[model samples]
Target: MQKILVAGPTFPDVIERLKQYFEVDWNQGNALSGAELTQRLADKDGALTAGELINAAVLAAAPRLRVVSNMAVGFNNFDMGAFNAVNVLGTNTPDVLNESVADFGWALMMAAARRVVESEHWLRAGEWQKFQYDAFLGADIHGSTLGIVGMGRIGQALARRARGFNMRVVYHNRSRVAPQIEAELNAEYVSKEALLRIADHVVLVLPYTRENHHTIGAAELALMKSGATLTNIARGGIVDDAALAEALRAKRIGAAALDVFEGEPRVHPDLLAVPNVVLTPHIASATEATRRAMANLAADNLMAGLGEGPQAGHPPNPINPDVLGKARRS
Candidate 1:
């Protein structure tokens, strides 16, 4: 049987499923370091990972590696260039977690706009004595303008949710989505600057790319309305956390919410100091059902890519499909 490494903690049931087809080396503990991962993968033929870095150096060490299936929609962890060069198939689980992540994005936006986390922390500390009508005043979601960066699956889901709130949706993406989709969501395509200027609440759903680094920086933040709220459900480094923290501290923008931060799980010290922001450890796709779906899909991708399952030789979500039939570099 082909040997595979499971590099992150996952549902044991998924492990059992994988075990039926491959010799599985599952790591149920903390994430393995690069050196440790290289060592463990040296003898493996394939691997299933959740946002673990899989690059050229690691590939060089794992001469047998032929496929890598990532559980999350984002394959930013995988070095696509290296995978393509080595003809190692790469796949990611997408679509399944879109709604769940969109739900979380909405939750984060509401939490920050309404000061949920800040007020909760105060209440927990026994600071609430009497209800002050003026205390924790926040922007209203209803009948407001909603700006979404990256109008992809999750972005559209968020826009659709805005209908009930009577929000006017405006989005800025690399390219405009289909006109039918825009009509369904009641969304309008707009320039990033226009979105910043008009939106009362802004949520980022863009993918991380070299060109997209710090997509929202000091300049973009400055462009937003003074009372506007900012929310990020996108990848870390997409926003300048330090700049955001400073803005929050100075009340340059109303409030902010972040689910992903640069160099996380080590957040910027300045962000932690600001009480106007809500922060969460990247759990946007964390609902039990959604996570299970992700795990199952990842398992399917791994098995199928390795030509061992119902969808043998046809993985549902191949990131680098060009490498599918190419001879392995090793």
Candidate 2:
């Protein structure tokens, strides 16, 4: 049997299924360091990863490696050039986590718009003696303008939810989504600047790429209305955390919520000091059902790409299928 490395902890059922075909080396503890990952994959034939960095060095060290299946939708951790040069296929689980993530995005947006976290902290601290008319006054979500940056699957789902609030939806993407989709969601395509200027609440659901680092920064924050709320459920580095902290401190923008940060698992000290912002440890796709679906899809990709499962050699979500039949790097 071919040897496989599972770079992160996964569902036990998924592991049992993979055991039927391959010799599995599962990492159930802390994330492996770069040196440790390289040493471990040195002899493995295939691996399933979750947001673990896989670069040319790791690929070069793993001569037997043929495929890498990523458990999350974002594959920015993958160095595609290296995978292509070595003819090693990469895959990710998409669509499965869309609704779960969308739901979380909405939760974060509402929490920020309504000052939920700040007020909750105040209440827990015994600061609520009496309710004043202006006490914790916050931006209203219903009948407000909702702007979404990066109008992908999750973004569209968010737009669909806005209908119940009677919100006017505007979105900015690399290109407009189909007319039918826009009509169904009642989302209007607009420029990023225009969306920032007009929106009462803004949510980010875009993928991260090198060129788009800090998709929202001080300048963008300056463009937003003073009462607007911002929420990001997208990848880290998409927003400048320090800049966001400053904006929140100055009340340049009303409030902010983040599921990701520039360097996370270690949120910026500045953001932590601010009371207007709500922070979560990237649980946008943390629902049990959604996480299981991601794990199973990743397992399926690993098995199929390695030519062992029912769909042998035809993994459903190949990121670099062009490398499938090419010569493997020695």
In the range 113-138, model 2's lDDT, one tens digit per residue, is 99999999999999999979998899
Model 1 lDDT, residue 240, Cα: 96
Superposed Cα deviation of residue 151, candidate 1 (Å)? 0.5
**Segments in model 1 whose C-alpha atoms lie over 4 Å from true places:** none
Worst 10 residues of 1 by lDDT: 321-330
C-alpha root-mean-square deviation, each candidate: 0.8, 0.8
- lDDT at position 169, candidate 2: 98
Residue pairs in clash, model 2:
none
Error of 1 at 284 (Å): 0.9
What does the lDDT read for residue 85 in candidate 1?
A: 88
State the displacement of the C-alpha of residue 288, model 1, in Å, after optimal TM-score superposition.
0.8
